[model samples]
Target: MAEKFTDEEFAFLRYARFGSLPERVKLEELVALNETEPAPDYSDLAYDAKERAEG
Candidate 1:
């Protein structure tokens, strides 16, 4: 089975895969912004209904 990832984890994965120095820096900026900002509600985001039903 595949593992689920958080937004931060996905960002890190992107950094590990195809990111350049600038991209890494931008990711850091995004992290900092996230830390300072209010968290977003993800209830409206798309999800796999089959996976949810299976779980």
Candidate 2:
């Protein structure tokens, strides 16, 4: 059986995991950064999946 965390313990766990992350970003800057990234290529992933299924 899994042990359950109390609210305080859960809050501590959440902070422990993400406390060091940057907590703020301008929406416009984030959008501009996102626009500069190219779309992901999944052709090789599809081919790998097809091979696994056929094998």
Candidate 3:
């Protein structure tokens, strides 16, 4: 099983995990990228062949 998170929450969680790095990513740039990028399309996610067929 898995838990789902909103776009904003996921972004924050990622930052919390990888915010510190020697590679140097600007927070503002990351924020802008997130704002411009579309969220994932999960409308077709299924558990098995039967669930997929139901769609």
Candidate 4:
């Protein structure tokens, strides 16, 4: 089994990984980014191994 990290260790890990962003992103910008992309079409995609093997 793996050992659990303490609160101090977890804080240190988060700081080391992400540090701090120079500027905060606006909520509007985030919403616009998501809206800009169209959802993908998976209508013709195979859902099983048998279908994949046949094709």
User: Tell me, what's the RMSD of every candidate?
Assistant: 18.0, 10.0, 16.5, 8.7
Tens digit of per-residue lDDT, candidate 2, span 1-55: 9999999998899889888557588876675333466755799788889999999
Best by lDDT: 2
Cα-based TM-score, every candidate? 0.33, 0.35, 0.33, 0.35
* Candidate 1 wrongly placed segments (more than 4 Å): 21-55
Question: 1-45, model 4: which lDDT tens digit per residue?
Answer: 999999999889988999955688777777533346664456534
Q: Candidate 3 on 1-55: residue-level lDDT in tens?
A: 8999999998899889988447777776675333566655565343455586887
How much lDDT does each candidate structure score? Answer: 0.67, 0.81, 0.71, 0.73
Where does candidate 2 have its weakest 10-residue lDDT segment? 31-40
What's each prediction's clash count?
Answer: 0, 0, 0, 0
Least accurate 10 contiguous residues by lDDT in model 3: 39-48
User: Tens-digit lDDT track for model 1 on 1-55?
Assistant: 9999999999899989987455235544554333466555565333555567779
lDDT at 11 for candidate 1? 88
Q: Which ten residues in a row have the lowest lDDT in candidate 1?
A: 26-35
